[model samples]
Structures are given as C-alpha cells and as structure tokens.
Target: MTELAPDAGFRGNEKLKGALLQHAALSPAGLSERLFGLLFSGLVYAQIWEDPEVDMQAMDLSEGHRIVTIGSGGCNMLAYLSRRPASIDVVDLNPNHIALNRLKLAAFRHLPDHASVRRLLGEQAVRTNARMYDRHIAPNLDAATRRHWEARGVTGRRRISVFNRNIYRTGLLGRFITIGHLIARSHGVRLEELAETRSLREQRMFFDSRVAPLFDKPLIRWLTRRKSSLFGLGIPPQQYDELASLASDGTIAPVLRHRLEKLCCHFLLRDNYFAWQAFLRRYPKAEEGVLPTYLQEQHYHAIRETTDRVTVHHANFTELLARKPAGSVDRYVLLDAQDWMNERQLNDLWTEITRTASEGARVIFRTAAEDSILNGKLAPDLLDQWHYQAERSHALNTQDRSAIYGGFHIYEKRPA
Candidate 1:
C-alpha cells in the first residue's frame, strides 16, 4: 500500500507525532527544532512567505480550473479566490491551519463589508473582534475549528481573545520577530531601522552597517547553529539542510543575508507587506501596501463573493488527491512541503497526481534550493507524464515578491 501519508490523522497526538519530525536527518538539536517547528505550525501564521501574485501569475487561473493548495496561513488560498476559479480545495496537515482557513472563509461569509475585514485581520487589535466573532463568525465554523479558537489558555482567556490584541504578533513568527528584536537590542542594533530606509541604496547601506554585522556576532552565530532557533521562521530541518547547501560562504548566514537583501532591497518597503511584518513586526499603514492580496480592500468583494467556492481539508495532499476522480483537478499549489518528504513519498505523491490531474493541469511548488528537488529523485517513469517549465519557473522564482524561497517550479500534464 501507499506509504502512510506523513502526519495524516485527526487524533491529536497522532497529528502531533506526524508533525514533529518529517525528516530523518536531525541531530539532537535538530530533533528539538523539529518539535518546536511542529508546535509553531499549530498556531496562526500571521504571514506566509509565498507570493500569491507570483502564484496567480503562474497558475493563470480561469473559471474552468479547479485548484488545490496547502492552506499554510490561509492567506494565499483566500488570495486565490479573487480570481474567481470554479472551485478551490485547500488542505493542510496542521489542524490549526485548517482552522485558520475555515475562520477566514467564515469571516468572508459573515463580515459586513471590507472595512470590517480589514480592521479585524489587518489592524487585528480591535477589542470588538471577539464580539464580532461571537456574533458573526464563530457560528459558521465547524466544531473542530470553533473549539480550537475557543479553547482556553493558562490565563483562562479563550484563545480567540488573541485577536483583541495584535494577533499578527501572537504566533511563532511573532515570537521569532520579538526574539530577533531582542537579539538586535543586545547588539545595539534597532531592527526597526530597516523600515526607515528610503531606497534600495539606503537599505543596502543600512543592512551592511546595521543588520549584516549581527550575523557575525558570537551569540548570534551560536544561536543560529542550533536548528531549533529557526523553528520560528517555519523552517524544518530538511529544508534547513537544503538551504544550507546553497550558501556560497559555506554557512547558512550568507543565504539568510541574500534573502534579507531580496526582502529589503528587491522590493520597496512601501509595497512589500512580507518585509513590513518581518522588519517592523506589523503591517504598514493602509495607504501603503498595507496587507496581503486576500485582505486588501480592492480584492475583498471578489474574495467574499467567491469564498464559497473554497473548502478546507485536514489531510495530506496525496491522500486528498487519491480520492478525487481522474482528470478532476486542474491546478495544484504544493508550497514547499515536498522538501519534507522522502523519495518514496515524492513518488507516491506523483503517482496520485499523475492519476488525478486533468490534461494541461499545472502543479506549482517552491523549494529551499535554487535547483529542482524532483529532477534526480522522482521516479522517471512517473515524471515523464508532465513537462517541466524550467525557464518560466526560474523567471517566476525571480519575480516572486516573497524572496524567501530559492526556487519556484511549474509542471504541466502532457497529452495522454
């Protein structure tokens, strides 16, 4: 039978077990990091690194396409809805992600207008969010998702009350930013200075002067050595190795430096929301880039109108695809998850994909390496059914505003 899908189950402990370690390459520290990463994935991802603009450009979605994607933060999936696809199915192994996706879907369905959506998701600190959830959003969610948010913490406060504060600053990414700020403070560097840079020249200068030096410090280097320290970045150990392999300087630090440069310099601070949340730990003012596409005022109504076409599943992609009829799905957004799978797992995935995918179906994914993961690993017999769009993939990888991932790949199904 197919290898038991990685982290596939509804039982809480089983889910956690699956989530904890998808890789075999961990040292003791790596194991700790994997555990931390698993726990981190169980909360809201105030931001996901994939660029939906680049994603939509790659998919070029039409009314005829049926889309499936991993609902990491539920951000890109909602962003996908703006295109008015026939249907989109978003799946994730993390129940928290499924919950987040459902909550977003529910918010789109129940919120009165664009301003309400923005205030709740963007500003994210309104005291009335809990009340709004009570009145408009909570009832619409399934029991599991509802219970997940309503569950109490040690303070006896319902976890849903997180929205009453800056919810963007609550999850693993939030804590990571806070810790980064703390580290920067100890080094006499204000992490916020990146936000004040006026242009690419200024940003590069500021980075060279202020940010780049932080990497060379003893404490920063010490912490960076422990893979657990990066769990906050949503980086798993497998992907960590892939990224580490890319460093021309033989350290992960340079790879990070290049990525930071891309995040800060390649895109203007006024427009890149990912950089805003990263450097400033919150989104910019509404007049600026402000928010993700799904949360933007211009796209709100379109997403709201089409939100009903979306559904969230707490399952592995291969498992989800296995149940679908042949030639049913037209688009797949794999995110960077295959980095977590083994060669057999990858082949198992393509086995189902080759079966279920419609003619001309497009599958897109990102990787921690600039080169492809599937090129040498995936079984050639299964791979031959699809054509890799290398030039477009490389071009799109450059255009990707996220700038975090090293590769963006696209594959199209061949004529049978």
Candidate 2:
C-alpha cells in the first residue's frame, strides 16, 4: 500500500471531529475502534475502487446525454468518460474522495505525459512525481482543496502526503479492505500474496487456503461485528444490517465469504487489476495497464480526454442530484450510495433522480442486499415511471471488476 504521509496536525481539527462522529455512529457497537487499530492504525479512506457497471452496447453517446455519478474513486467516471458523453458530474460526501478525484484529474491533465502519469499513480513512486505535482498540479487545485492536500505531513512534498498518511477511508469499500489487510497481516498471513498467483486456479486456491481462512479465525470474526469496521470496507451501517440477515444468525463471515468468493473465484485474477491493486500494490492500475484494461491500450487516450467534461463534487448524491436541472442527466452511477441512507434519504435521492431523468436515461447503482433499493422504499408513482433493467443488471454484475457488490440495478426513465 502507498504510505500516505502522517498528519501530525490532525488532532483537534474539525475534520478529525467529523470523522470521530462518523465512526461513532457507523460503529455503534464499539468494535470499530479496535478493528480500526488492528487494520488501518491510521487515516482511513474507504472507497469502492472498482468500475461501475458499464454497458457499451446500450449506450450511444453521440445521441448526447449528460451523466451524474456517485464517483467513489472516480474509476467509473473515467470509464464512463471513455464513452464520450456530453458531460458527467461526479459527487461524493467524502472530502478525501473528492480530493482524490481532483488529483486523478490533475494527473491526467498535467503530468509530464501519459507514461509519467501512469508511473506516478500506478507504481506510486513519488520522488519525481512530487516534482511534477509541486510544479504543475498544485497550482490548479481550488483553494480549499489545495489546503486539504497541502496540510503538512512527514513528507515535505504535499503529493507524498497521500502515501505517507493513512488514506483508507477516502473511497467506497477500500478502507475496510485495508483494515482487513492490516489485521490479517498482524496475524501473519500476507493478503498481498494473493496477488502472486499466476493462474485463476492459483488465485482461487490462495483465497480459499491462505486468505479466506484468516477471516474464519475467532478474533477476525468478532471484529467483523462492528459497523465501523465494516464501514472501513465501505459497508455502510444500513447495508451491514442486510448482510447480517444473509446468514442464519446474522454472522458476518458468511457475507464476507460470499463477497470474497465473488472477488476471487468468479473472475480471472490476472485480468482483475482492481483486486491486484487492493490485495497487492494498494494502488490503482499503473500506466502500463494492469489486468482487464492492460490489453485495451487503444482506449487510454479516449479515456484521458474524457476527463475534461467531468466535474467532481464534494457532496452527497442527493445533494448533487438536487442541483441538477430536470431531465438534464441521462446516466446515473450510484455505487451503493443508497446503502448508507435512511428511507427518507433514499426517497429524496430517487425523487431527484426521477426528476432529472432524460428520455431513455439509464441509472445504475449497486446494493449490499440482493434486492434493489427502489422496491417499496421508492413511491410507486415514480418507480412505475422508470423501467428496471434486471437482465442487464445480472449481466453486468457478472462482468463487474471487483465482484464484491451485491445488486447491480439499472433504471431507465420513460420518454417524456
């Protein structure tokens, strides 16, 4: 994992206070702190670092459609950008995630070139990359964001700060996985070894024998009981309730086992670069391409250029949707954002989503529970107006990068 610089000044700050409050509510059972110490032992940036469901066949970008996405780690946004949409707006409540998105954007725009950009973010080597950021990238940051990134750390170079500090809680589900890795490492088995597999069978074997067995241990199982611990993995408290229901007595291992199986056994480990990043390097796919996209180098520039039309917002999905004009967006990628909301929040989010629907606009999101969030929670009047692409959901989930998410739902707004 890239070591983020230490934030010695974090104590007594509002950000720390907010994180504390969030951790308290998210981990009400009091197990999160211990699990957190065992796992992260530092700043956590929980993120779903995988791509959102991308359906190239159904999407005709030249038809001109605006898109809104939850933008966990902005991977989906970059992938979506490859389709050449009219515009894409990405929102996230986590400031760190927002900053991470900006950093990604900066890398795309200002790095010495594509190769260097890849080296900086992919390999995570920061010496020369720090020079690149200090000379070019830092000047482009918005004031508040600049301060956020510039907060001094052990590394005098601000870019190195991301590596020097603990950045586990910034995205969707990454933080929890980071926590898991830390904890599992403390127990002796290196989760990073799962990345050493040369074949799909080896990957499967490593997961079953070396990796999954660690979770079966008594202490790890006990740690899984905490909402905060799960939150670190980007499992919101509300979703944890549903996941608990999946087992007879609401045990977490079964749910975790199911998720891990999907991640390891369901796909080719060599092609699943997201898994390689999570379990091995603790970074995104490098410039040379890692797994799935390694062979698709032709799409790289198209992907890079798509960055221009995308704007990252440091706000919740509901808040972002609320500001959008009616019928202005054609695609929505809400990656398990509903898992974190209450019914009221869910209603508001869908209401704005429905209000913003353009003709044949497609909205995609994931859920912790097998069921879609729209069932009874969304009023029938609005739900009925939109078409659920259940078949498409199944197909995409099968193809999803990490395969850890439960339900991948797609909704299409009827023509006005």
Candidate 3:
C-alpha cells in the first residue's frame, strides 16, 4: 500500500471533541484528563497480553482463505498470521490503532532481522528505542502517523517513554490495575508479593478475599457501572448501553467480577507472557530495540510468515463484509465488538458472513454479557446455515487466554 500525506488543512476542533465524549456521556473534565491518557498514551488493553492459544484442533487454518478481524491492538491479528492464511484484513475505528498496526508491520517487514525486530518491539525496554524510532521507525512512518507519535510527550523523548514509567496505570486496563493495587493495599495484601504465594489455592484465596470484595463495594460498583468510567478500557458509551440491555437490572458487578476473576485466577495470569510484560515489566521485551515472540522457537517462524499475508484497514466490519467476495474468509476474530453494534449492523455483518463463508469456516467472537450474541436474534434462514456449538464454545472458552470476556463463541458455516 502507498503512503498518504497528512491532511494539510486539518485543524483541531475543541468543540467537536467536547461534544463527542459528552454525547458518549463522559464529562468534559474526565475526557480531557483521565480518558485522554488512555487514548493518546500507549495504554492499550494489551490485546495480546494472553495468547488466545486458539485451538487449531477443530479448525484447519491451512485451508487457505482470507481472514477478517478487528485490529484492536494488532496482537491477535499477528498471532493469527502465524497460521498462514491466504490474506488477512484488519479493520478498526481508532486511527491510533491503525497507525500502531502499521508501525508493527513496517518494523516486522523491514527491520534488519528477527532478532533486531524483537529488540525494538519484543523487548520494548531499550533506552534508545526512541532514537531507533527517530532513526528507523519514525522515518518510515507516514507523515500523519509520524506526527501522531512525535506529538506525544516531550521533545526528544520517544513515545516508548510511557513504558519507562508506570505504563500499567496508563490505559483503561492500567487504571483498573492501579485500582486493584490500591484495593489490595487497602486490604493489607501487597500485590508485589504475588510471587511469594507458592500455590494457586493461595492466589485464589488472596484474590477472592482481598480483590473480589472491591467489586461488591457499593462505591466501586457505582463508579465502574457507568459507561464513562470504562472509557479507560476503551468501552465506548454505545457498548455500555448494550451491556445494560443484557443485564436484568443493568448492574455490572457480576460481569466485572467474572472478568476480574479470570484476570486473577485463570492460567491466564501464569501462562500469559503478555501479562508478565504488564505487571512485571514496564515495557514489552525489546532486544537492543526489537520485539521477541512470547512463544518458543518452534512457533516463531510459522508466526512471522503469517505477517506476509496480513493487511490492516481502517473500516467497519459490516462495510468490509459487504464488499467481500462470496466464500472468501476462513476465520473471523471479532473481539467483543458486537456488543457495540445495533441489530441492523449485526444483521448486515452476518448476512455477508454467511454469504461469503466457505464450507466449515469458523467464526470466533466474544460478548460483553454471558449470553450468546446470536442466540435468538438472528433470522433462522441465515442462522440455519450455520452451526452454533454452545456446549463446545463453553468448553473451549475454558482455554481462552484472556478470561475477561463474557462469552467466546464459534460458528461453523454449514454447507450452502
């Protein structure tokens, strides 16, 4: 893809920015202060924090079809690329994310070698990363994206400076982690001592007694239940409204509890090298200035090759599906995005999905609520052609890397 110039006529619109967040029910002060850091800073949900360890047992990725996904932080997109699909199209509404994905792709493709690539990205802790970006990464960046990274923080300081400090307290999830630490402190349980706890049972007991009680508190519940409060986690007001619709009384404590439980209790915390990056390292693994794989040597080459066929876009799912040729994509990774869509958007997405699906295509997505997104809402005509493995989805979900999701579903496209 060819590079494009930054918009010369573009001007900051203060009024529009205010109203957009307000319309999303976020306060102007909160938007400018707390939410700004989450959006602008590299404080992402760490989408790849836990390898999904997507089970290749039931699905055959070598079938060689195109793939479409929401490129939240680009980790999963890159992870899926390891499977060697014919092509991958990644779309996201957030331009920051788009730019970030582009940066990763460029680094992976042009960096001296895998080791250097790992040093710059995987380690992410090298003191000269900003220098490397200025030298290698930034020069290659498109004008707009270059400006985006350059405009961040102080001059001569690269964007990676956020990691040198308390980056964990930066994003939505970061704020939550901060809150968790505070709560842990309040209960006289220091989170820094997690390693001291020798057994899983001890970890569970400590979490249940100390952290879990925070969710049950009326004040925490009141604050977190609001849409604006969750902006840190990048949950827009629209998705919050849908989440309200899913619950009986719109109380979010249970949902929050479940996610927090997974974060604290699941093999996720133990096996996830990404989580280790957050709680353990302020930055990702960077060798000299390259990024290393979370996996061992065996999976590295396979994963890197997947990068060849991957393409990231700044588009909506429904629109992308509408334009796709019939029976094109093999796997769909929609990460809890449907909770933000309306019935029409849902229908449009699935319509094209069923129309374009090859036989036995597997579609995976998560939901904000425990209920399946497609349970009864989808039209039977379109629904009949797909198989919903509720039992299997439930079973497979136990293996999901990030336990934060409410539901993990797989829809197998039936014969046309």
Worst 10 residues of 3 by lDDT: 7-16
Question: What are the Cα lDDT values of the candidates?
Answer: 0.80, 0.63, 0.61
TM-score of 1: 0.92
- Model 3 misplaced regions, further than 4 Å: 1-51, 55-59, 154-169, 183-189, 238-250, 274-297
Model 2: CA > 4 A from native: 1-47, 53-63, 154-159, 163-179, 185-188, 283-297
Tens-digit lDDT track of model 3 for 97-206: 67667767766665555665555555544565566566666677666777766665546665556433443345556666676567656756566554444456876885
Model 1 spans with C-alpha error above 4 angstroms:
1-41, 248-250
Please state the error at residue 348 of candidate 1 in Å.
Answer: 0.5
Cα-based TM-score, every candidate: 0.92, 0.82, 0.80
Per-residue accuracy of model 2 over 11-91 as CA lDDT, tens digit each: 322332232223453554334433433333233343344554344433444425687776555556666666677888877
310-354: candidate 1 lDDT, tens digit per residue: 877767888789989998999999999898777878999899999
lDDT of 3 at 211: 65
Report lDDT (Cα) of residue 259, candidate 2: 79
**Order by TM-score, highest first:** 1, 2, 3
Q: For model 2, what is the alpha-carbon lDDT of residue 398?
A: 72
